[model samples]
Target: MCFGYWLETRGHQVTIATHENFASFVRQFDLKFAPIAGNMEEFLQSKQGQRLIAGEKLKKEEGDKLLLQQLESAWSACQGSEVIIYTPLATFGYHIAEKLGVSCFFASVLPLTPQGCLGF
Candidate 1:
């Protein structure tokens, strides 16, 4: 959110695409909000979410389903975008940018592992 605000201050139009749960908070910064599908709060209270929080890897099918959902929603949110700034978790951003022939940047607050860096 701060990054979006900073970009706005620099005269750039910045919109944050995130879960609906964050819409209010994102709007507080006066940033345009493009809501991605999913109820993060409810998810966090589910068994799968609990497993994820416990560091358990998701089953392959479950992971794929989640990825597909994210890809679809994020693609819609990114329409007509000239540049895409995304987090590591949103790996679909790279593919979307490639298809759109636009610049894409990866931003993260966490340290990247050697394997993760290689993947990027």
Candidate 2:
């Protein structure tokens, strides 16, 4: 949001594609927002989702690749945008944008990784 606000203040139009929760938050700031696939909150509440995020579960089949599906949906949602500024969890945006010839950038807002805890 800080980044989007900064860009918006500088006269750049910014659109955020994320979960409905995040989209709603961004909308409160008067910035453009688009909903991405998968209910983040609902998924996070699931045991499988919690295990997957904690790395306690390994992908065994197509059904286990929820992360990939989420990213793919995000990629699809990014179409027509000038650039895609994505969070770490959506790293696939960078690759997808590259393939589509769209600009891509990364921004980390939450320090959810252990490496972030180390002050890196």
Candidate 3:
């Protein structure tokens, strides 16, 4: 939501696509919201996702597969963005930006330290 606000303040139109829960939250700010494919809640409730969240180590191939799924989910909605800016965990947007030939920027607004208020 802050990202959308920043871009809007700078006179750029922004449409955000994310999990449905997230989309619902951002719509309160009056930003455009599109639902990214995949049931985030269901995924979170799944054993695999739960294990990952619980900090089970991931093999490189497993990690790559997860990233690929995210990329596929984000692809269609990213179609018309002139440029893409993504939060750190948004690995999907990087691939979409590349495929669309748009500039891409990645950032993590949350502090990396363990004691930081916004962990993710």
Leading candidate by TM-score: 1
Q: What would the per-residue lDDT of candidate 2 be over residues 39-108, giving only the tens digit for each residue?
A: 7788877876788779786557733576666777677678787888878767788887898898888978
Q: lDDT at 55 for candidate 1?
A: 96
Clashes of 1: 0
Over the full model, what C-alpha lDDT does candidate 3 score relative to the true structure?
0.75
Please give, for residues 1-120, the per-residue lDDT of candidate 3 as tens digits: 675777787899898878766876888888988776666677768886687789897677755765565667678668788988787667767877988999999867575555422322
TM-score of candidate 1 to 2 decimals: 0.78
lDDT of 1 by residue, 16-72 (tens): 998889899999999999988787678778998899889999898866776677778
Which residue pairs overlap in candidate 2's backbone?
A: none
Error of 2 at 54 (Å): 3.3
RMSD of each: 6.3, 5.2, 5.2
Query: Against the true structure, whose lDDT is highest?
Result: 1
Q: In terms of lDDT, which candidate is stronger, 1 or 3?
A: 1
